[model samples]
Target: MEKQVKKKKKKRCSKVKKKMISSLLVLFAILLAVPVVSAQTSLNNNVPSSNSDATLTSEEQKKLDERTIILKEYFLNVEMAKAELDKLKEAQSENVGPRASLVEIDKKIEVAALRVEELKEKLPVGLEKIQTAKESGNVSALSSAADYAITEIQIFWDSTQSKYLAHTAGNFTSTNWKKDRETDPYMTGWRDFGGYDGYSVYSLHYNINIYNPNFQTIHHADHTQYTDWTSTASTYPDARGYAWKYQDKGYQNWPIWMTDWADYNNWRQLGWYFFDFVGGKPSGNASFSASFGHTWASTTINSISYPAGFGWSTNSNRWDKGQSKAFTF
Candidate 1:
């Protein structure tokens, strides 16, 4: 009985050893499969999306994207500006009046439109270059395209303002000068006047004509003098019952009778001499007197004084020949 029990125990021990070995094999297979599956998942995750992966650093990529967006915005802005300009042109054409700058505006519009179109057409090329620049990490190429796009957009904006000026407003004009002449003088020998009231006249032009020859003579007091009678033997006796040989002798220096000018426009008053003279005569010799006056324009007059009033005359206690004339021009 004891020997039989020992044999059964040995058989059971062998069966248990075989089961343990099988379990070990299954665990080893699971471990090997786990590595392969994990490796495949990692490779799939790392695979490049498109062969066109950018060589730029993260910061460089960000900058390029920013510039590209800005360029696109510029393109859109320019397009809108062009549309507004076109509308303005159409309105200007329909309601036409004195379009003095219309032709110039049209030419400028054409040129600016062409430039805008050209810039717009080149946008695609610039975008492609930008893409390549980002891929190759070529900062210089990206900068070049950015600079050009910015400059073109600025030019378009400036042109739009110029177009607005030419269409809405007129061209700049210089202020001009104007002149006036006054030819009617109140009296003979009086001068005419000329005046300007605008921009200063750097140059002068004149056309003067004289016709209808006519002349006139008039008495004018040039100058005057007075002298009292003296009790000397050299004095002439009273001839005409006057205390002195000559009561009062009037002397004319300039021609008292003057002729009228046919046509005279020289109205500047270079200089003049006029008189308001008063004199007294004691018992002396004969007396002489004269007066002179000058005038130019409407409000200018000149006078000079020598001897013209009266004091004690040989006959009359007081004598006078001083006179003033009222004139205008």
Candidate 2:
């Protein structure tokens, strides 16, 4: 009986030792896994996980993307509004007629002002979000915002000049006559020389002939080339037709010639003369003045001679011609 009891106690002690060893092994495994799980969780928080079952929150990402897009659009709208305002100012300055057009431009200005205000409201919040992304080292978000701003500025600059041209009708000119000549047949080519700023220039060609009763050409062809400058103010003499004083140093007087009109019969025949003058620079108190006169000799039949004078004033707008007096014969 004593041997059996001793054997039973030995068996229980062995069994208890085996169970404790198994429990210790299981506890050690769990302790090792805890560190790995902690590291994985920290990595997932900072960057996207590669695990097949892992996923980023789509709702949060979608909201961020949408906000970025809206901000970009708002920037573009602001730039566009600024360009429209510039065009409106240019149109008003160029003497584009029709008072009603200005009213329309005013409306456009109001609309642009409203749009700019709206953009300013959006820019602050959008910029804050972009900055937050950058702080977290999101390179893509930073690049997107910068690219959007650059594109908006470029688009504004490109469109502004085109819109200004459209609004002013390319700067108003009086001569609408269309005829084909050696240089420009379309007559539309006249724009190459018309406008207030010395920037525009053109060349004109004309032919005149006087015939005798015998059908012989009495006055043959006369050809001349003229350089013209247009400007609101005169920088150089001989630019376009504007008020300018002849320079004392390099100034050269253009030769003037009158066409013979005796062959044509009217109480008083009209002859055309060509004069080239450089446009004058603008001055605060500057005014335009022009003067021309004619001299004639006494005829054997009547002994009559006279001199005529003409003059005109300059205005901020149109070039108005002054009254011309006729020379008595």
Candidate 3:
């Protein structure tokens, strides 16, 4: 039956797709270990369905399994084509080899992209059919299998994603901070006049190679800033009529190192700054606990002076921090 199905699918698949099928098994094997698709969660991050295998009869379970396998193959076809399309575009942009070679690559890209789009479009048809079966209150066996299939497919997709992104949620790989420290000053103001929310931009650079050549340099703020200021150790927080506080800058910085981005998405940058006040000492310390999915880092600066608020922290306050292991996700 699958032979007949493949024969039919082949007529619609371009030569580019034939090349894909030849390597499909290998790609899927690697996918098991290489987490993929930064857009995976962004595209469809639905929760698992309430329907489960344990609730289904044996025949229903068999049907669900069959549906799951078929759907997985279809999804992988789309993914594989996308990966191919990405590689082709990357190569075309570089204008590698000869002009003739570039032309050929572009044609391949067009073909692969069409395959991706077609596969993606077809995915919803099957899913919607399953939904219709459930909503119609008929075909109890098919409806039961539908819920189980959706849940299984989601699990399968998630498992595939976990392959490359061992550090799930965010796909960027980890890198060390290229130290860019600043000298301590008797700070009394912010780099930017954000009033009580004034802030000085401090950045940690990670010249990262996320293994996947397609991964781009991502610049974003951490989910939350783990910060603590000492009223006893630093200038009086309430003294300035403000309580000490710290937060991400909430925007991208054209930092000095941004130019270095041309080489690699090197310098995965995280923007965090401190702003707050207290009625206490003019100088003390501030600590931070930051995390994104699988990666975590912590830092503390002791030179926090009053009037200047938290000042700026360029390199974990001149000291590098170790990787944080604890993550909620």
Index of the highest-lDDT prediction: 3
Error of 3 at 245 (Å): 33
TM-score of structure candidate 3 = 0.28
The local lDDT score (0 to 100) that residue 179 gets in candidate 3 is 21
User: For model 1, how does the per-residue alpha-carbon lDDT over 177-276 read when each residue is reduced to its tens digit?
Assistant: 0011222334433223221100000000111111110111111121011111122101111111111111111122223233223322111000000111
Instruction: Kindly list the per-residue Cα lDDT of model 3 for residues 1-329, writing each as its tens digit.
Output: 99999987787677768888879978888889965533222222111111211244566445444443444344434544554565577577777697888888978988988887787667523343111112223211111111011111110112321211111011122212212122123322112111111111111111111111111112212211111111111221222122223221122234434422111121221211111212221232221122211111333333332234343333332222112111111
Comparing 1 and 3 on TM-score, the stronger one: 3
Tell how far residue 153 is off in model 1, in angstroms: 20
- lDDT tens digits, residue span 36-77, model 2: 322101111112111111232566434433433343334334
Listed in order, each prediction's TM-score against the native is 0.19, 0.21, 0.28
**Candidate 2, run of 10 with poorest lDDT:** 211-220
The residue-level lDDT of candidate 1 at 26 comes to 97
Alpha-carbon lDDT of model 3: 0.29
